[model samples]
Target: MSRSCPSRDAGLFPSEAEIARRLSQTPQEWAAKAKVLERDGLPRVDPLMGGRFWPAVRAYFLARYGLAGAEALAPDGPENLDAL
Candidate 1:
C-alpha cells in the first residue's frame, strides 16, 4: 500500500513518487530498484522523509564510478590522469 507523507514532511524531501518520476519508473519499478540497490549502497528511505536522501545517492554513484572522493594525485602525473 502507498502511504502518504504527512504535511510536515510534504516538501522536506523527495518521496518515492518523486524519485520514481525522476528515474522514469513507476512506484513498482522504483520498489524493485530499491531492493536491488539496497546492498549496493543506495541510501535507505528515511521514514521521516518518506524517501531516500537524494544527495546520498549521488555521492554513492560518484564514488562507485571513481568520479569523486578519490585521493589527490595522478600517480603517473597529469599527462596520464584520464587513464586512472
Candidate 2:
C-alpha cells in the first residue's frame, strides 16, 4: 500500500490520546496493549505525523470480525435452526 493510503490526509488519529479516543480506550489501556496491537499487525506510529496507519486498523477488524472470521450467517435467515 502507498504511504499516503493511511495517513493524516486521510484523517489519521494523530496522537496517542487521539488514538485512545478513537478506540474508546483510556490512554493507560492503549499504552498497555500498544505492543501487542503492533504484534498483531496494527501499524506502527509514524513519528513525523505522530499517527498510525488507519487502514491497518480497519483491515485488522475486517479480517477478524467483518467477513471471514465471523460466525456464519443463518442458512435461512433468523428462523434457520441449523444456524444454531
The per-prediction CA RMSD against the true structure, in angstroms, equals 7.1, 7.7
Q: Write the per-residue lDDT of candidate 1 for residues 4-81, one digit (tens) a residue.
A: 555523454677776677668898898898899879878998986566787786677688788867657757644766
- TM-score for candidate 2, residues paired by index: 0.56
Give all TM-scores, in the order shown. 0.58, 0.56
Model 2 over residues 1-84: C-alpha lDDT tens digits? Answer: 123233444484456665666779987798788878788777888787667767676667677665635566658645767777
Report the alpha-carbon TM-score of model 1 versus the true structure: 0.58
lDDT of each: 0.73, 0.67
Most accurate candidate by lDDT:
1
Which numbered prediction scores highest in TM-score against the true structure? 1
Worst 10 residues of 2 by lDDT: 1-10
